[model samples]
Target chain A: MICIKNFLTILVTFFLILSCVLTAQEGKALQEDSKNSLISGSRSLQFRISNNLTLTSFEGAMISAKKHFTSNSALRFGLGLDIRSGQEDYGAVEEDDNLFELELIAQYIYYTSPKAPVNLYLGTGPQFTYNRHVQDRNYEETGEDAAWQYDRSWTIGLLATFGVEWFAIENISFFCEYGASIGYQSRYMESTPYQGYQDQETTQFRLSSQTVDFGLSVYF
Target chain B: MSRLKKSVIAALLLVFGILTGTISGQNDMQTTQDQQPGPQLEHTWSFQAGISEYFTLRNFDMVSLSVKRHFSNKSALRLGTWINFWARETSQSEIKNWDGTNADTEIENRYYFAALSLQYITYLSSGKDVKCYLGIGPRIRFEYWKTTYESKSDALTRLGGDSGEIFAGLQSNLGAEYFFTDNISLIAEYGAILDFWGYSDLYNYKNELSSGFRFSLSPLPVNFGVSIYF
Candidate 1:
């Protein structure tokens, strides 16, 4: 009975795959006639946002740009920096939380169909991220000493990306991408002002299909 | 054995039927579109939210959101995300048994999880107000959790260490969506995954890493959701 179940599962999965392939080819029908969209020496600016469907609030906003070497290929660079400070107060107690983050990414993108309105693309490059966070708590009437904690970390990695892009008009396009990464992280943490700091290092490998990134680009 | 053979034959026949039906359906749509020239309701942006099986099964513990942009009536790009964050802090006071003094304890815990998915979608068939489409994309996920404890008494004060894990992974999914109305639709999908996890003793700064790969299929139509187009 178990063998039969497994076979049935595989059979159904195969059918699904076949259906996808057949329907995927139908994408050509959606292409609109647009010319000269991808040209050499063209520079484009891209703005990216985390793929949050509700758009309740936006997080991880990144600005990047691309310079086309050829109609089929380009070099892209991105830089991001963010600082946050928050405080909480409860009568005689006060708490503060602060964070600082910076990231840099450089990648090479290759478009498989440069002339088509809908293009499939692949990108690979190096990425680095740094973060610093501090938290503090203070008591006024209780005569307790103020307590603070600090943490810092930096990550360097190589990332591979796959995505699809659609040009709505001659000068504007929207793209969606996913990435996999292998990297290293170094971290330092201090539990309290009096306690000594601890240093740690980690080697990381990740395949993150769940972090779908969405972005728009405009050519100048 | 006889039953197995019969099942295999049935599966093959079903596959044939589906394939032919899909091809003929596309043809029929084209012919209908050509015959009737009406206002095409094509919206470029859509938003969707629903429940998923990967995080938690009961009481809608996991919430998923998705947004799609249609390049044309036949093709589109979709991005979906699931993000959650929770934090708690507690304090307790009790009398020490031996010292007959007040003992105070404080505990803090925090957890976060997020997943993002992207796919290219193509419409295979369409009816008057319904469309059947296929979508495939990559998914990435991250999770983190940490907890710390502190205790103070008359004679001595002790601090408990912190422990947590930072996990990240990638996966690929293939799914299909059916639009029942001009503005509403439903989707179902499955995928293969590769995940990596890092365990840590935060106070001591000790870390360990592990990774694995697997295939996931959440019984058909279970990982389903609704979408609204604008």
Candidate 2:
């Protein structure tokens, strides 16, 4: 029964291969560069937001604004927030996981040149995240809720990113960034009915990805 | 050569052939377009987020996002990520004993995976507002599966277990993108993959001795998404 699914996967593989071979002759011509293309240096300051047409992140929305502080340097500040209900169930237990996260970041960027449409940059900032989850479990024999637990944590991290952005049209552009974060986290967890109610606590230092974001910018 | 060796060689040859053909076609297209004026087609960066697995039973269970950059009119590269959420959870039911007496137990399960890949693409046909490309790449995947069982009388006494696996695969695909404007386009693609995974010491409720390896080939690795080129 399991191999059947595997077979389907294999079948899909062959199909893609065949399609690539057969269409080896279908495309038309080389795309040429336009003479009237939008140039990046034309704009001194810009505001950007998530171009997400779909649900891509935990944050409901992301907004950032950037301004040129010097001939080849700039500053940007960003904010991202998410508020949602979370749930965790452990058979006999059901729990509510409510999450409220706010990330604030400030970055300094250096552009290559005033007229260069392709700009390279490096940025660093801080990020903060918080989560609180509650869980409850019950017994079938008792037909009532009984044991429960709650876990909450806060994280503070430092981030660094290096990437580039290209202006493709009049007011819109795309950016790709790769970065990492190092941070400290503290968590508090408590379980009821644990030897008549005991609690556990944890603290740790961690490293994580600060990447990846593909965003759109509408320049003014 | 052994069958394994032959398969590897064939894969290499296949990839080489596609890349060579794409390069030659690019040269031909450039030469032809040099004589005439075409729409200024300078597209360097693009982002795409779309749905996949449209033809399978687990349709629309996968979502993907790719950040692509064109190095030339004919060649491009992309970094992509895929997230799958095909896990289903059933409500816990009371465990029954052979004697028709309630055993007072319940259980739940969840399974999912995440993947990342790097792709190199050559435009077979490129125009100001449209493009068709063929590409190949390597992908890495991490999969997790777990189940939980609880005694109705004690939540803390419940057992939660998990198994993890890592896979590496080579993938190839053919795709097209049509720009509605200079920035936004509708994109679609179908790819093929051969994924290999090996592991020993799998857990089955209690830790048991289990070992295996798998090399799976899947057809119709499909995707449809909106892309913004900048």
Question: For model 2 chain A, where is the 10-residue window of minimal lDDT?
Answer: A28-37
Note the Cα lDDT for every prediction shown: 0.62, 0.59
Model 1 spans with C-alpha error above 4 angstroms: A1-32, A47-62, A85-97, A139-144, A193-215, B1-230
- Tell me how each candidate scores on DockQ against the true complex: 0.02, 0.01
lDDT per residue for candidate 2 within B63-177, as digits (tens), equals 3667888777788887877777565555554545444444455566777878888889887765555566778888888887777766665433446677667778777765656
lDDT of 1: 0.62
Whole-structure CA lDDT of model 2 = 0.59
Q: Which stretches of candidate 2 lie over 4 Å from their true place?
A: A1-80, A85-97, A137-145, A170-174, A193-197, A207-220, B1-230
lDDT string for model 1 (B1-230, tens) is 66667677777777778778977897898798667633243556887665334422221113366678888777788787788899999898878777788878887878887877777777654433334455665666667676666666545344444544443444333343545555676443333334444443444222322222222221111233566788
lDDT of 1 at A23: 68
- Give the 10-residue window scoring lowest on summed lDDT in candidate 1 chain B: B213-222
